[model samples]
Target chain A: MDLVLLLQRIFDALFNSAIYSSLALALVIIFRSTGLLNFAQGEMATFTAYIAFVLLAGPQPRLTGGGLAGLIPGVPFSIPLAIFGAVLCGMAAGAMTERALIRPLGGASDVALVNITIGLLLATNSLMAQWWGTGPRFFPAIFPTGAGQHFTILGARLRYSTVGVWVILLSALILLVLLLRHTKTGLAFRAVSISPSNAELVGVRVGPTLMYGWAMASGFGALAACLSANSVLLEPNMMLRVLVYAFAAATLGGLDSPKGALLGGLIIGLSQTLIPAYVPFIGFELSVLPALVAMVVILLIRPAGLFGTQRIERI
Target chain B: MSAQAPRRFTPVSVAGLIVLAGLLVAIPFLTTTTSLRQATQIVVSVLAVLGVNIATGYGGMISLGHGVFVGVGAFATGYYVGDLQLPWLLAIALGAITAGLAGALVGVPALRIRGIHLALVTLGLAIVFRPLSKRFPSITGGVSGRSIDARFDAPGWWPSDGRMASSVYRYVFCVLIVVLVLWATWNLVNSRFGRSMRALRDNHMAAAIYGIDLVAARVTTFAISAGIAGLCGALQVLLVPFVSQDKYPAQESLVIYASAVIGGLGTIWGSVLGVLARTVLGKAGSALAGYDGLGPLGEFFDLLDESAFVFGVGLIILTFLFPRGLAGLGRKNQVPK
Candidate 1:
């Protein structure tokens, strides 16, 4: 392949990595805080994206141009306000799910917990299908999506939208770092994740911290969903495939490590892009194969993952 | 007067059994061939659900990739019959064995991983099955998949048209196989081996301390479970007599697990109930969607077209209300909690 083409592929991979990392971070946080593998994370985010879409642009635009918009006639349509509202809703949904589903079934076996999440997955996806209609809806872009919105960088054309995605992700990461390291609530959340019993004895509110973890994870998921919907149009089953990719990324990076999730996402994304280009045998249809293969191999070699702390079992 | 006799069957029970037998016999004649096809699907699902019950319900292993085994069985049948021009029965056997062997391969890893990790590994297999099948075009017939030309028509003794005869023959064939398999499974579950398997599921360290070979029990359970799934796949192709990559997807595994749970896991009769519940619920969804009587709520009714919503609600309610499942209802000495 030509140098320009390769560089462009690298750029595309970076954009994909940003989105995948966002989803992977969401998965990692939940696993770390709750000790539960939430299978519904992606679907919940997809539901949130649909909510944002409906707020900003829908057949029946309740906030923008019709329904509720008439009640407040002075304010103009704002995508930013729509996204903010959607994220807040996402946080509430996360808190509600933790309270309603997880709390009620407390002390249940792992199988039961997993099944409940699976149930949530099915419920969320199908509910979205019913409300949004299964057909792909045109989600208005938050960044410029036109072909003209690009510039040559070292003989390689780079889309401004891709740059926008990176900027959003980078900002989210910085904010997360600040929140977890410098804030009192973030310390409580971290303490709970490390040792819930200790945190509780130390006067940290364990239940609310866990809920905040879910809320933060879901908020990131909603942002990732909006990024993806901008590129791939809105559909109910869109997250199904993406969820698998995120799983591979999270597992590859180590389930409990945030930095590892980002690294794993980038590695998987780049390999997915580069493999079909270089290797003629594995075609585009099997683009996901490399990431999965990488995951399995990494897991077999080191079950704790590349950056994950080794879980020392004591008999 | 002091000697008590064993009550073999209550009159109501005997009468119910007779009624059930009569209905089974009359179904092929009374219902249209389309309905027979539905019955065939139910039997196949029962087999798959039973497979899941053996591993997850009886053996305490979580797998979300059983669909791959079924897919393998279907593809194997398609390859043998379509590509090799083999007999239908042999093809089915080969197909089932292929799935069983694949199951054993997966079981090797199950030895190390437990709980969520095992679930992840199995799910990975399901995700990989599709692309792998697509990659091997000569074996799997690529994206479009393979179709079988071998037909098992009715014998000369049966007096019926070709279509009806074929449907009845398929139904009878499925029923016979299901009965035999059910009997075998019942025996397996009740035997001394079944006790060891149950011990293993209930407690690993305790089972190991009691002279149970952990590896042997786990492998055997997986093989048997996978073999049953394979059989279901083979039977499935014979019903429609077509196999494709699209026939079995990863999400189908979730439905199979749900069916096993909904049927009341580990119980023999629950498998049938689970399939019946699934088929009945599906038909109800379509019916509910078709109804146009509700004025403003008609829009609400239209949402029933989304089968996953109904299934999700049903699963959550069933899990909360009766963790043991529909089969746990109205049994002697039954204790749910």
Candidate 2:
């Protein structure tokens, strides 16, 4: 039991925990408003990350490839500006997806919803591959990540990027709380999430409210992708593995609970880092197995999760 | 209850059958051995799509991880044939059965997890499979994948001994197996057990009231569906003697599911139609992609070359325009809840 190594691992795990927490929060928002899980969330986020990449890299056809690259502005933007632009683009896309694709279905079957999302996943993934080659692209870190750019405490070095990510995550989370609690739109959103029919009866536009929810969720997802892109490397399939971890976190915290998503993210992220370190066979690549197994076990024993409301079905 | 009327083949259907049969017969002569093998591989993929149809459309379980069973089937068949020194036919059968047993294992979890959650779990399984299989290098050939030592070849009774002959032999075998399985599945879905399976899918409580063993029906439906997919995988090895993890990506599973949906679910012919649609669309996309005169539009055309993109867009369009799928286009829009 090397205490220093363990502490170091925990510090490393916190960065991922923040990533998973934000992504899980994104999942929770959508699931809370609509019963359908957005399987395309990761891909959508990845697309935004690409948008940021294009923004930062400017109109270099050689770098960004053909197609939409021709549409990007000629001047390169700073990293924060590029990320900001990407998040905005992501929010708009999310809202449009909800309005165009999902709303038209008008409360379709589970299978139909699954088909639509999966369709989006496949299309967006290939589209990214087409625009930006399947090869990994370098994304600049939002925070300084040079050697010695870390804090030492208790004989363990904590990277500045980890603290910087948490700061961003926590501030965004606080903003989310404020918006949800203080704003009228947030109240309407809460009402819609609780009961769409009732909210409609009370004069709230359930459709637009749900669209806002989707936008907000997508914004969170975009942020997660942008923040983690430096660490994970930007690619079409970058978020596929991260999506699993976030889903596990969401499920663990209770699929429909926001606070649970954050907590679940913390726990799943730590386990992801620690389990692989301790378990000889799991290694780094197969660490996803534990998160998956945990998800199955949680689904089996506790369908509602720690914080989610228990669903009552009438026969 | 009064006896139901037997379904009669319409003139249109008879014409369709004739055209399909003619195309199947002409394929070997029209193409080289390589193209013939590719055509056979496309035909074999129908079984995988059909597996999804059974589990999702007929059995009422949305299994997005049928590709896992297919991978298991291929790997297991490779092991049984190459390592165990068994005959190809016996190994193929055992391979399918092995996949069926694995499906039964997944089906156990599915008993409690229904609808979208089941879909989530299956998708997770699909993602996990490649990494999981990599751990077993001996059986799965680790990361890069292993090649089988033995080849499935034609016997000397009535055929010329050549590479083309062996290719033709494998193609015929695959087509025969696919048709046989399709016929068997059609019968099974219309049988008493099949009724129970559908009954459970429609309403498990009502099904249980009608004396259907919910557990047995659900598990068996998944098992049979997975077995069919496994058979597809076994035939894949027969066509190309390579078993690799790269072949079974999460996207592959989604594509298979998309095929099932696009072809239409709950109908045997829908499975075949789905695969046909995929083949036709892929060829058309690639041909269009190759044309340089389209200018800026060529970029969009290039996207067509990627089957995942085509299927993804197709799935969305079909979901909106023809919820019942291509097979259900002219039929009444009576999509079951």
Candidate 3:
């Protein structure tokens, strides 16, 4: 019943809401185009975060060991530049993954597609562990997070980092909206999402359009990872739990709806923070349980989700 | 019932069985008691993979959380044997039944959820299992897992009373149970119910039209599959005498599912082949990891030490090359879709 405390929790929850939204958006993009869930999305994003770490730290052999540090230039880059570079790498990797691993399947069974994505998840996860040790590393914050870096709103401290992340997310979203609404490639992507065969019939190049979608999705994932790395710490398994929340968000939003992803993320994020604060049994570590239960309930009762199109099955 | 053509065994398969039998017998003698126990554990893992095989392959429902059932079996068996002072065999049976009941509970939700959605739910279960198990300290041993006071040792009438004798006894017991389960599963898959299970998998609506009870078949398939995995977990406790939540990670479930896919899903032999492949790949990877002198490639070689890495790469390569899996290689028109 404490209004200020509740406001504080809600403000704190907004940071995670943005993160889940971006990751869920990434998932929605792929599902819309390819009708496949990228189980490896979290790991792929974490890998980019590591890349950004390497770029910022240069060739610190003690930190990176004999891993990927040797491959990069021996000069420490600025944080924004490093993140930008990592996002580009992430985009490239996403495009390549679709072309190499997914394209060859040519619409295989659900089992086969699941196998590929799960395979990628396992491989990338262990590869990261092998390269960088399993121990968590300290990642520098993008925004200034000093003791007095928060604004006082109704006696609650709203951190500057949270506001900064939201600004970046809104800008990126606006850019995405502009690109989708006023570009040839965006039209092709929309057409392909509606119907791949129809888009191909009109010569929109379905494969390349899907590839772009994957790239964009991966880019969003990279941004989420880099921004949140400082809070969560850098580790190989850092994103595993986050992936569950993101998946829940996507499912709640409607798997193939972009706006649903954003809304779902907001709801999931608020509940994730608020539920644990109120309920003693569902502690911090167990907050994911509610998201999962919500996902199951939604899937059972409303498969289409809030913003998604209902799927009609043919006998 | 209609008469069907008798099954034929290929010369290659006959030779394979003979070699496998020889290896199983020779394993205890050739290795130390420690390695012998490890070998027995590997053999026991086949049941878990087979569990995934039944649900994903024959039953046409993908279960990425079989490891949770295995954990349930181990934890339940430990509680029964240690706390209730039940006989080991009865405890093991009860443990499997408990896991089967749990599987049935999960299968109720699975009645409406299908394909990828079911996969998502199961994966969520896999991730949640560790934290959930940690909540029950008395049964699951909480954060650090508790050890069972009772040890599964050899009987007095066995020729020798040394540690090696007990190790050998456990090995033989595990191998016998694994074979018995395999034999039982082979028969189960060939029964009238098995045919209906397959029919439902291929097309549920058509199968339902043909008088197949969709709900009963799916739930039973999951229960039986989970029971098999539970048996594997019971044996794990019998071998190690310890149960921990750490043993059943989300990745472990994925690896188990990967093994089922890589080995060939539909065939029972595929489960064994998948486990064998995992063991061989793991041994080879560790051996290669021990070697030095590879300048730049040593880092890549280091990654080989992790079985998850090996299995991941193997899963992808196998998916590309042999979609039907290793059991499907060089054989045609045998495995049902």
Candidate 4:
């Protein structure tokens, strides 16, 4: 491959990985602590992005007064504020879902719990369609837009959005790492994940910690949604295919490890971008196949994933 | 007293069975052609649900890609009978066998990953099925899909003619196949292998320690279920006379799972009940959506147009209310709950 083409693919992969890692990280948070894969993670993220859109949407330059858009009066819809609000809203939604639905079904079998999440997925996606109608809506760009917003690196020009995505992803990672490692709540979360009964015995307040874990994970999911909406616009079904990719990434990384999620997401993102660019037969139409097939192959060889601890099955 | 007790059948139960059989046979005469076709579709759904029951309910393997098996079966039949001009009967059997082989391929991963993980793997299979179907233009007819001109017409002895004849022909075959499969499933569940399969589902480690070959049983169960699902697909194309990529989206897989769960997971009768409930409720939901009498309530009812909402709520409510599913309603010894 030419160096320019190779460099462009690398940059594209990095940009894509930023979004995938955010989602995979979110999935890992829930799986590590709750022992259940949040199948609705992507839908939850998209729902939060809709909240972001509602907040960011304002009267056009030609229009004067606003009704729902001017809820704060004279603020004229701030993108940063909307992003912040969406993240908080996502956290609240995640916490509410955990407390209201998942917690109540704690006694149900794993299969039942999984099915409930699937139900949640279907309900949430359709709710979006019913509420907003089933069409792609204009989502405002959070990054700067200009013709001169490109920099040549290794003979390939990178857009400002690419850099912006990386910045957001890195900040989210740092914030999560610091929170999990330093905070008392984080300690309690770790304690509960290791052993809920033991953590409860130690007065760690297991339920709240789990709720916190979900909240944090969902906040990351909202961020991922914002990053994704930057390119794809907003639609109810936008995240469905992305969710499959995230699942593949999570499986490849190790469902129980945050770092693994990040690394796995990068690997998957790179392969998905590069394979379609290079391979003659499989084009963009079958782009999703390689990553998923790779994940399955990895799983068959090492079921626990690259960085996950092997589960010891007791007799 | 010296001889063994004679086989006993209560008069009421015997009467109930006769009435049920009468109703089953009378469906074609009683309902319109469209309704008869819908009934055939429901039977096809029941067959698919039964496939789910064998693997998930009986074998303890959670599959989210049962629809893919059905799609494969449909595509197989479409290619064999439509393209190759093979006999429809032979095409259906081959389609089912092809689907069974695909199921076994999917089951190979189950040997490594299971539970929700297995579910995720199956779900990936479902997601991949759409694009994969598009890739093979010759077999699946690419994005446009393929259509069959050969109609399933009633035999010479039947009374109906024209479209009704085809409807009656397909309906008769569906009923026969449903009954045959149901009986075979009943026997399977009562047999030694059935007991072993149930044991494996309940506790795989214990079953394995008890001398059961876990891999063989699990893979075989998946194969059988896939075969049944494939048959449903073949019957569906036979009834509808067309097969397209749009016909079997990934979402349909979830709907199939919902049907199996709604029907009562492991029980054969539950599979039938679940399909019946889904078809009836689905039609009722659409009817409720079109009902325009209640002013603002009409708008509220219109949301029922999104069947996912109804089925999602149904799945949750049923999981909570009747863990054993709707068919478990009258049984005093319902398991799980």
Candidate 5:
């Protein structure tokens, strides 16, 4: 009701969207490489987030008020180091999934792979719930002690969590774009995307290249998971909307286009934030409405996705 | 119809099915209460799995939203029986019919599109459908859910002997519903309509080119699948006297797909067998994890996680190793793919 408070909430929403966009980018990366929808994508992110949670719970070095060690005296390792562990965990899970689960089912139908991923999702979720007991674990935020916490810009209070999310997302996006554009691995990845058989014939290690693609996607997914985990309580259901929103974003942007995921994510995040705020009929209950509407619109107008090449199936 | 041609009425298959029906009829007399309880669980699981079989197995359509159909059926049964005060049998029929019609409607967009797009839509359906069910508390019974007790009564010929009589009637109802489904599905698969359904699955383009009528065939199949799923929901409500949306979540659709795969797609017996395996494995895992008998064996075990992890790993392995499922595996051993 208060204009200042409302703007602050909107700012917070935008800040949090960076994580969703980043995850959307990860999904886009995998789709670009393998053309698989990767149903287990969000769950894979959850696995890593849980890893980060466990790592965060480790013993911490003693610190004075100004000392770096003062934050949550339990975690033995540096926050960055724990993040590294989580990233590795995410990448490894992604690789194992690609090599063990996906590769073996090669030449099978698309539905089979999707179904397998769906199964993977349930399996992973159950395993985690059994281990973690379905309770939310406190995740340590990476922002500086007083960073982005209740800073008023244009009379709106903004949290450092929001700002940190945006910064990480932008940095990751830039890194990803650069990697895809100029790097040798990126070139090979793009080649695989365009034509896997042709790329393999042209001396690209197509299999490993695809695996790397999954690793990269999952790695970014982990970052998104960690960032979002800071803001929201990380539960088994934490990543539920990640996949849906990401899929919609990726689809709207162009299923196979990384840039599309970013645009799609931002657009979705903004709409999701803005719609419920401004629109009268669509209340909080319809949280998923914006993403769903955007998706239907994109699919109807551009079935191949916003930025995807038109697919033509001939007899 | 002569014995020499396809039209021949040998009734071998039908005769075998009837005998199986008779065996199912005898199940209440043979099994313990514990076993009957387990069997009841299997029946419920199979109801949802039947929808998955219809949507995923036979149709070559992987729907992660069949849970919604089950939920819809359950809620409808709850409303019909719990509120409208309808007969048990009519409630079940109506519930299934309602879900079937809903499934047909959901299939409209899918009738035009193909692949991942269709899947995303269905996934969205599963996600949204749950909330929608929750919102309509008056019909759905909301969070608390509604209990259903009106089952086929004890026959006039048999005297009510307390616990034994009650359990027997419930078991009979469960078995009767299952056998009826199997028999109906058998006739469905062998019928021209069934063949067309298979054809549509086998080669959608070829079938369409040959005049299979894409809209009618696909939509009808989707409806039938949803209807079967609804029938399962109603049966479960009848058996357990409980119907809740939480019982059928978006994830349940995934579980059903896994069941369909393990059971083998495109076969009636496979669907039944798949449901049995799923129920047994899932139940055994949950039950035996804390079992005292496994004191010595317990050191080597954790059974519950097996279902959770194994479901996904199993699907991945089966798709790789035996794409045709258990039925296909059986057939392969008998002859060859």
Candidate 6:
């Protein structure tokens, strides 16, 4: 029985780990493509989740009701439409930020861009809060609402939705890796990432690639936000904690390396679960502390992050 | 020595300043209740901005945590003015000195790190200051926010509630600090030490090549800048005689930077100009007189949401248009051709 319980504990840990990784991956995507340590990504995600709530406000908020994500006889289509609307808005928001703030100061160094993003994060969140008001609103589960809907394989009960999250992340990761590996646009992105000046010489459409990166990032961000909002209702400060995790994951995985970002997310997720469970007095409040400290220390030692070996400028 | 450094005080300049100073000093006597309160707040921020000028404007180190130090000064002044009941000059001296030490403690880390990382650390201190002030409510008066009408109560010869006399006394306080700080900064900047800071900024390696002690200059600059920020914080604390963390939050740092840039980077007079713009344009300025956020125009145009947007855009525009800042005031002071 103890042996079965240990295995169960490990499986449970992995499931919990993957959830945080989803959000972390979104942060990593933006950081890798654009050299912006975007503090706004989480807030952007929160804003979209709030929008999703607004979209389903009139109809049934619960999935069983007549609203979006509801299982009501006639209103099965609202859920997917709400999700689509959120994704589209996220993409538009990302692009608008680029044009309004980043594009003008295109030639400026990364530090300036980073500070600009910080300013954006503060300003946008405040503006959104003013519009939405300070309240947590319900966001429907994309899949089934039942926690008991689990698959028993290898004598382990696997949550259908939890398993679905992993499958979605893995598929997306593979697609991203392949696109970067195989396509011309991906190659242009790689070139720009390595050296913008050289990429300009190579005649790659760098501006569009940056926009592409932002779009993909926001799309993934929307998905992550929607899913997390299922567990925790949407609030303006919803993404603040997740942003810190993603930053830690990105930093650990190698800030500039995409593969590193994936691994970084997994490692952070595991440690977050395992450390607190295994160690006495290592509670929830302190779980993120380790990750944050580690990232800062790693950056200090390796400046480029764990897997990042490139000589990125200090500023 | 180029006739004691250009202070925007050539023959024409002197006449302009004399008239301006005359007006500022004369306002209280001429104005009624509401105007006196407004003038007092303006003068308070002016002194506060002068401290910002020393570090960011002259030293080229961004210290957003200047507000914490300002609060320290205010609290110290509050203790001296309201509690200990010391005289104004003595209270100012003790408050400035006390705040300067606090500035040095914060300045030490700045000596190690540069730019945003350092800015964040100082900003973090500002974050800490709010909670810490409240935590030690005995000293800070916590959320209640310690207020003192003692400073407003004029001394023996000033005559009680005499608006003109009260305004003159407050104006004298601002003018004395501004003149003294500006004069000292001018002397410091024109010297070889000032050249070394500029050199380091232009090219750290090249500056080192000239045999300048890079660390010493950097640390000294931070120390000096911080001390000045502390001084300003102290003055600001006393200027209103209301000591609280709400008075000096992290946002004040941004205003200081904006004012410094708008006034003219490294220009003494520019710092004052930057303060003037901030006092007049932003809500923090408006807050001095008990107004919140921007006025109607701010809301209608969404300027309320885009507060830093204005500063960020303004900095870019100013940098492109005139890298010189308000230093134009010093042009004629170049000693008769």
DockQ of each: 0.46, 0.84, 0.73, 0.59, 0.46, 0.15
Pairwise lDDT winner, candidates 3 and 4: 3
Candidate 3, residue B333: how far the Cα is off, in Å: 6.9
TM-score per candidate, in order? 0.91, 0.97, 0.97, 0.93, 0.88, 0.71
Which stretches of candidate 1 lie above 4 Å from their native place? A1-4, A58-80, A151-153, B1-23, B137-141, B144-146, B159-163, B330-337
lDDT of 1 by residue, B1-337 (tens): 0101113555654675587567668888887889898877776778888888888877788877888889888888877877789888898889889889989887877777777877766766776678878998877768887667777667788777676888898888888888789879878877878778788877778989999999999998898899889989988888887778876666677777777778777677667778778877878887888888878787676767766676677777777767777766644444332
Model 2 C-alpha lDDT per residue in residues A1-315, reported as the tens digit of each score: 999999999999999999999999998999999898999999999999998888888767686443365575654788999899899999999999999999999989898999999999999999999878899999999999999999999999999999999998899889988999999999999999999999999999999999999999999999999999999999999999899899999999999999999999999999999999999999998999999989998999998999999988888
Quote the positional error of residue A214 for candidate 2 in Å: 0.4
- Writing each residue's lDDT as its tens digit, candidate 4 over A1-315 gives 598898888887887788888999999999999999888899999999888777676544422222455665544558878888889999999999899778877656877887788788877887788877778988877887577777789778787888998898889889887887999998899899888899999899888899999999999899999778867779987787777788888888898988889998898889888898889667887887887787778778887788998988755
- In order, the Cα lDDT scores of the candidates are 0.79, 0.91, 0.90, 0.82, 0.74, 0.64
TM-score of 6: 0.71
Ranking by lDDT: 2, 3, 4, 1, 5, 6
lDDT tens digits, residue span B40-100, model 3: 9999999999999989888999998999999999999999999999999999999999999
DockQ of 5: 0.46
The digit string of per-residue lDDT tens for model 1 on A1-315 reads 498899988987887788888898898998888878788888898988877776665345533233543454433347667676677788789888887788777666767776788778877887887776678988777788687888788888788888888898889889998999999999999999999899999999888888889899988888888788877788987776667677788888898989888887888778878998899887777877776666666667777776877888755
Candidate 6 i-RMS: 6.2
Could you tell me how far off, in angstroms, the CA of residue B216 lies in candidate 6 after the best superposition?
3.0
In candidate 3, residue A19 scores what lDDT?
95
Chain A alone, TM-score for each of the models? 0.92, 0.97, 0.97, 0.93, 0.87, 0.84
Model number with the top DockQ? 2
Candidate 1, B241: how far from true, in Å? 1.9
- Tens digit of per-residue lDDT, candidate 6, span B156-182: 776555445655666566667767877
Q: Is candidate 3 or candidate 4 better by DockQ?
A: 3
Q: What TM-score, to 2 decimal places, does chain A of model 1 have?
A: 0.92
Poorly placed runs, candidate 5 (over 4 Å): A1-9, A59-75, A144-148, A278-282, B1-26, B30-38, B148-160, B291-300, B303-306, B333-337
- Return the lDDT, model 5, position A256: 81
